[model samples]
Structure formats: C-alpha cells, structure tokens
Target: MVEIDESHTSLPVLAFFRSPQAGRSWVTAAGLVLDTANLLFSALDVPRSRQVELTFTAGCLAVNRVQRFFDKKAETQPTELRTPEEVAAANPGREAFAKVWQELRDGGLPVRPDEEAAWQHYQALRMRYAPSIEFLSQLLLAPAMGSLH
Candidate 1:
C-alpha cells in the first residue's frame, strides 16, 4: 500500500484510513474533497489550474454527501451541500434501514421488511448513490491504472 502524508492529501483522505478496518487488503484509495485555491499555497507539486479547480468542486459535493451519510451531527455545514436528487434516490435505502432498525417502543419480534422489499430498497439506494462510489473508486485507482499523469 502506498503511504501518503497530510502534505499530499486532504481531510477526507485521512478519514478513509480512520474508518473501520474489518478486512485487510493490499489496495486502498483516497477520495478527497479538495480546495482548488489552497493547492497554490499548500502543495507545490500539485497542479493549480481551472480543470483542477472544477474537479475539486465536484469532489467537494461528492464528499459532502458522504459526510452526511457518516455523520448525523447537526451543525452549520458547507454551502456546497448534497443535491436533492441524491437524497431522493437514497431514501429507499434509508427507509429500508429504518424498517430494520432495532429500536422499538413496544418490542415484539422486531420488524423486518420482506426480503424482496429490502432488496429493492437497497438496490435503489445503491444505484442512485453509485456515482459517489465511482468517484472515490476512480480517485484511488487512477494511479494504479497508470491513468494519472
């Protein structure tokens, strides 16, 4: 695995490492929500250009969705937040999760959605939120695939 420090990466990159490590693998990737303007001041080796800026903006949006997924905390968030489309698409998965959640007021056998319902809800969410996954995946794979110049 390639080791990169703060100098070479961003906060979202660090968060990926701090995340749960259930299985070990030789491969890992960093999906960063980067700052375009900061690159000029921080990483001298990194590019400072319009395309880089735009890419970073897109990364910011993707990571924001990811952040809201992982963090339920209420606070003043970045103005560049997740789009309505993202939320709508992921709602089925959210509803499926809500149905299966262990929380109960008057407990019984515990509510469980039917297998087909669960599967459909989950698939909907996954398909909708897949771009975020793809973005992060490509970010990590680019160097390995020799697509990064």
Candidate 2:
C-alpha cells in the first residue's frame, strides 16, 4: 500500500500497473508542474524553486521510465495471469526508479520545506505575476479538462 500526497510525483507511477490511464494523467500533471517551475526559475533563483522542481521532475522521469518498463512487460506477458515474478524481471529503468522512489517513500516527500529564503523569493515571484500565473494555473487545473487528481 503506497501512501502519497495528492501532489506527490510518485502518485502517477504508483497507479501505472493498476490504472494506466490514471498513471499517464499523473505523468502529464507532473510535466506541467515541472515546466511551470522551470519557466519560473529561469529568470530568477526563486529560493527553493530549484529543489522543488528538480525533485518533481526526477520523480516524473523515473515514473515515466517505470511506466515504459511495465508497458514493455505487458507486451511480453508470458502468462495471462501477469504474476509478480514477471514484474520483478530485470528492467534498468524500473530498477533505478524503484530504488529512488523507495528512498523517497521511506524518507517522505519534501512537501515543500519551509525555508525562509525560498518562500520569500516565491512570494515575490507570485506577487509580481499573480494575475498571469493565476490565469495560466487555472488553465492547467481546469475541471472540465479532467485535471490531475
């Protein structure tokens, strides 16, 4: 039983085997978040921005790789049962991601640490571009489009 916050990057990968569509959605959501963070950080450091976005992107990439692994595995399913043994087979991407996600799981996701410097920078960015950002974020979170849950 994997426990993850709604915004956790691993959320998508965890859903991969169980619900591929959901997993894909999580990946897309992660991409949007990463892209936003990168765009924000390009002009300025934004304090903890680098840490936050990097962590998210790392999770996203790892999960995506794992998802690709599963897709390949599904294609080569030896038995209709799709046993755990099949899933445990050698897959470089999945193996690497498993290790990282495991550590993250054990330690707990960063959950946006409260570093004063980072927060101040983030606040300044938000204040400077509140309206534009709000509009863009709204597009990202639009309910009608079936956003990441």
Candidate 3:
C-alpha cells in the first residue's frame, strides 16, 4: 500500500507497472476518478479552473493510453467505476512508490522530496472536494430540477 506521511502536506503519487496489463488498470482507475470529478464539478456550476482542466486532461490521457494497451491485449470492456475501498483493495503497484521514497530518504533520488509530498496534498484536496462533487452530481440529476436555482 502507498503510505502517506502525515507530517507532510503533499501526498506522493506513484505509477507502477511491471507489465502492461497492470498499467492499464492504474490508468483506468485514475481516469474514472478524474472524469467523475469533472462532471460533478461542472454540474455544480463550478468554473473550469486550470487545476481542474489539467487534472481532467491527465485522466483522459491515462484512459486513452490504457485503452491502447487493452487493444494490444485484445481485451474489450467498457470502463468501470470503482470506489475508494475497491481502489485500496486492489493494491495497485504501490511498492514502486515505497522504493522511490526509500531512495529519496537515502538521498539517491534526484527529485525533491517536496514534489513527492504533493500527492498527499492532492489527497487532502480530494477529500475536501468530494462533498461538492456529490452535491453537484445530485443537483444535476434531481427529478424535478426546480430547486437548483
């Protein structure tokens, strides 16, 4: 599991895939999160902020690359939505993250530790934004659509 350091404000984001198959899974999961967030934000009348756009684009690119990999594997299936619990359960290539962190701790890695810390920050931000996302999704899909104003 990728462990977040509580003392740090940033969360470390790591992508690990020894095989192309695992890579696809990571990409798909990330893409789903970003896409869902985007739709929910837009529905809630949230402006297209630069951070949101960048996140959305990164998700889409990941999805696209994963799709290409799936094509190579001759697999076909629609994207699936996964909950945070499911994501954690998958144990998706987190060891790579640990290795990178270890290297940084040993002063062998060139990347600044702060850059890795950003992942923790992102996670915190995600939690804060989740309520907004849910509210927007519900507001957009309400049956009467009369109380949104």
Model 1, residue 60: distance off in Å is 11
Model 2 clashing residue pairs (backbone): none
* Predictions in order: lDDT: 0.35, 0.36, 0.36
- Over the stretch 1-149, how does candidate 3's per-residue lDDT look in tens digits? 01111211122123222224422333334434653454334222335578767665555444444334333443433333545544343232234334534554465434334534533433444444333223322222211111111
- Once model 1 is optimally superposed onto the true structure by TM-score, how far is the C-alpha of residue 88 displaced, in angstroms? 26
- How should the candidates be ordered by lDDT, best one leading? 3, 2, 1
Stretches off by above 4 angstroms in model 2 are 1-24, 43-50, 76-149
Per-candidate TM equals: 0.26, 0.29, 0.30
lDDT of 3 at 85: 49
Angstrom error at residue 28, model 2: 3.3
Q: What clash count goes with each model?
A: 0, 0, 8
Residues 56-85, model 2: lDDT tens digits: 556444444443443353332222332344
TM-score result, candidate 3: 0.30
lDDT of 1: 0.35
